[model samples]
Target: MGDGRRGSIWSIPEGQGRGSRPAYSRAQITGAAIRIADADGLDAASMRRIAADLGTGAMSLYRYVPSRDDLIELMIDHVLLEADVPERPTGDWRADLTLIAENTRRMWLRHPWLAGLQRPRATFGPNRMRLLEFAFGALDVGFPIDEIFILLDMLNGYVERVVRGEIEWAREMRQSGMTPQRWMTESAPYVRELLGTGRYPMFERIVMDARLPHMSAEEQFRYGLDRVLDCIAAARP
Candidate 1:
């Protein structure tokens, strides 16, 4: 990526961040933008497309959200709001966080376009801010606010990484005209050769037991949540 587009696309424009309240609210425009993103991926979600969805001229949207980057940020926050978090303390902390993580994964799965958009631009909309606060409030840990933020950030980062991998795998499958299993089958010979060596007995056992229940995204999310809860328990006074 060229420096100009790289810097501009991933980061919000300076001065654009502190927008005065306008006649047209950002939430309304952001709602329209998110619909566009949901129906079509980010590349197809142009300013003109969003404007059409909002029944406004493209230039009119600029009054609320100046650049495409701002629209992308709004769209992410809007879709994130689609995630349904349970009421606090209704379940164990591990189960509660697992639910949040799985819901987050489902949100990305529903809106694959979300995986492609740059998150650095999404500083925080009301919905996301509330969600973050809810996460912290639900946790039993005694960490400082900054540490809580870092933990939530790490969780979000891990979920995003998983979604991105799924999206990339889907894209590659479409381009290659082969299923992921087929691709793996074709490469299995080399993998087997490496595993067949006596040095990798554990690796061989793990690979040979392919029938062992592989973790789904939901399972993986729950496992990670359990580990986090363990850490939080250890950190308690």
Candidate 2:
């Protein structure tokens, strides 16, 4: 007979039945998977690979994780533990949101594979639920639930978009020895020629006057986050 925990990984408890003891914990399997994924990527953390890391046969892991999709769901939620979210929102919406944003960015950067996941089904793991509460509660001050949803989505969208670019750029640098400085140096002549054409006044302005293009990635993120928070503030009644 099945335990009846079919669809969602969260529906199944870790050590449910009465037994001597389970040989492996979900955390152990998830941790091994995360380490492999961190080093190689999501696909490399296959059942066989993870089991090999744990010094067991691949079939043994299914007794714990059940399936590859379940394993991935576990892996995604496991790393959310690194976000270091508080038990609840701090009541200062800007500070709370900023904390969430920064922590989320750091988490995604550390686990760049996170930016590649396309799981449309919502997996409400413990850590994910905690962060969700913090985010929604922070924005729950006076706005309607729909607006709160949009605002949170906007904030998360901005953070994810920026981090995705950063991750790709880092990968490019690793694969091809590319860097921002080298890119600028190589593109300088074409940029100069374009500027001399005076055909792109806005591009000229960006080239001649923009400070954001020159800021460090961290600085750029902070500056943009501040602008996003300002917009959120403006939305308040």
Candidate 3:
């Protein structure tokens, strides 16, 4: 990369300290942003807000970190560090992958704002690279590079969608102050009318039977992960 490119925020090489002690490290700035985003949401994490939190003028922040977009890239990579992608992988690919999925889901759930990050602008940082490397190591199979990447994409997509839905539900419930039980009570009359019409046989049957297991968020995540892993394995050989 060119010198200009090397100095960009996405490049972790710049994170190395200057000869003298710097006023602040990228870790401190990124940490402040993460705390803001985690407590509030992504929009709440502006450069000015973070600068105020760090007790510095907003303009000075630019001297340390280039821009808000770069700070976002830094925040994302810092958040990935919480996932704790293990360096040592189990010999069993399926088990290792399950660990990866669980860790990823756990991180997203902890930081709900992360679910809404713009994917097109995702800039991989140092920790993200390490996370990807660990994930690749977990895939013990002798799959081609293309197929392995496809598997990683599938896994990442599945976890992101699932966690996004889960966070949305919790956010909606909090915003509306309507518990699921209260929601069911409020909609009971309309639901009864729809069921009484006998227009929806499948819905009627599911309601009548209630046979499906009411899995918690974690359980539901694992259930879907298992099925996806099964398909990937079956497709392999």
Candidate ranking under lDDT, highest first, comes to: 2, 3, 1
Compose the digit string of candidate 2's lDDT tens values, residues 1-237. 123466888887788666578999999999999899889998898889988999999886777887777887888888888878788888899999999889889989999988778632367898888878878998988999999999888988899899999999999999999999999999999999999997999999999999998999999999999999999999997
RMSD of 1: 5.8
What is the C-alpha local distance difference test score of candidate 1? 0.68
- Residues 123-170 of candidate 1 have per-residue lDDT tens digits of 477667767667887663666877766776766777778778777877
Candidate 1 off by > 4 Å: 1-28, 86-91, 120-122, 209-217
Off by over 4 Å in 2: 1-6, 17-20, 119-121
The 10-residue segment with the lowest total lDDT in model 3:
1-10
Sort every candidate by TM-score, greatest first.
2, 3, 1
Task: Identify the superior model by TM-score, candidate 1 or candidate 3.
Answer: 3
lDDT of 3 by residue, 1-237 (tens): 112444447554554545555688788988998899989899998888988999998776665677666777788888788778667666788887887789888898898888777562455787788877777877747887788889988988999888888888899888898765677789879879999998999888877776333566677788889989997898674
| Local accuracy by lDDT, each model | 0.68, 0.87, 0.78
For residue 215, give model 2's deviation from the true position in Å: 0.6
Assess candidate 1 and give its TM-score to the true structure. 0.74
